[model samples]
Target: MNLSRPLLLASNSPRRKELLAGLGLEFKIRVKEVNEDFPEHLKRAEVAEYLASHKADAYQHDLQNEILLTADTIVCLGERILNKPANYEEAFEMLSALSGTSHEVITGVCVLIKEQKAVFHDITKVFFKKLTKTEIDYYIRNFQPFDKAGAYGIQEWIGMIGIERIEGSYFNVVGLPVQKLYTQLKALGLIS
Candidate 1:
């Protein structure tokens, strides 16, 4: 089909852009806002997957015979879903709790083409080093991690200094799981 149609990224995340760019595929972004909420019955992975698929739904009419990608990443520590922090205090609290702990980073993704849609997710286990109060405070004040889930960025200062190790895809901690995404996109004939 000759790349049939240009790939459309239904997100504004810079991390997603970076991840997609690694594929060496051409794509364009059209920011469309979607609610990050889900039903109370939805569990951890379900919430992420549902939100990602919902993002793709925004471009249903705009989509032709092309691939539209959408994704949502969430951090879960125990039963608590630590979403993006609202303020510095909350951000500090989130990071403090994450210190010296392992948390799950789940990303739900959707690859939509016309009527056919593939929805899936990748999980990464990130372990942080025990961060001192001063270290956490420094990160919060310097990075202002309002754009990141769990109030921290894996590629930022906190990640470089605080993240001790990870058990899964590093890119997944950053945002998108490029390896899984590559396999899925190739299987769906979304990329060369």
Candidate 2:
């Protein structure tokens, strides 16, 4: 794909990078550490959008001829948001809570070009089969999903065996919602 402006991706997430690359759009990775904190009142999609925009805001002064992309993915179980786990115990607990349940995976994306910005979010409902304690422990010990939100990767072993189905874009669960992102880029006349 050809972009009208050079692309700068403001994230270090390997999953996000891979997903964007799969879209065949070339971009340079230019991440700066930004505060991921958000207000307590923001719910699922709101939190993700807020964080994505917050990341984009860090690059506000850096734009020249390049379009900036930032994205944040969050997992929500009912009213609770499951952030990345701090350690093995947290990962186990997160997976336990997610077992035999349906959760929403929301990926919020921000595309910024000079003074213009577009922010949107995509949500995927993921259904998990009842996972055993052993399965949870095994996944945590072997996969080490400390960097992934919800302490799980949908393309990993746990998901291969535990996820029963998904109602939205599967790529959204991995990290990026490429379809919606492509639409947004096209709408902005960044891609043809």
lDDT of 2 at 116: 92
lDDT of each: 0.88, 0.94
- Estimate, for each residue in 80-171, the C-alpha lDDT of model 2 and write its tens digit: 99999999989989999999999999999999999699999999999999999999998998999999999999999999999999999999
Top TM-score hit: 2
Prediction RMSDs, each to the true structure: 1.6, 0.7
Model 2 Cα RMSD, 1 decimal:
0.7
lDDT of candidate 1 over 26-67, digit per residue (tens): 789877867777888999999989999988888899877678
lDDT of 2 at 5: 86
Assess candidate 1 and give its TM-score to the true structure. Answer: 0.96
Instruction: Report the lDDT of model 2 for residue 138.
Output: 89
Clash totals in order = 0, 0
**Which residue pairs show backbone clashes in model 1?**
none
Model 2: which residue pairs collide?
none
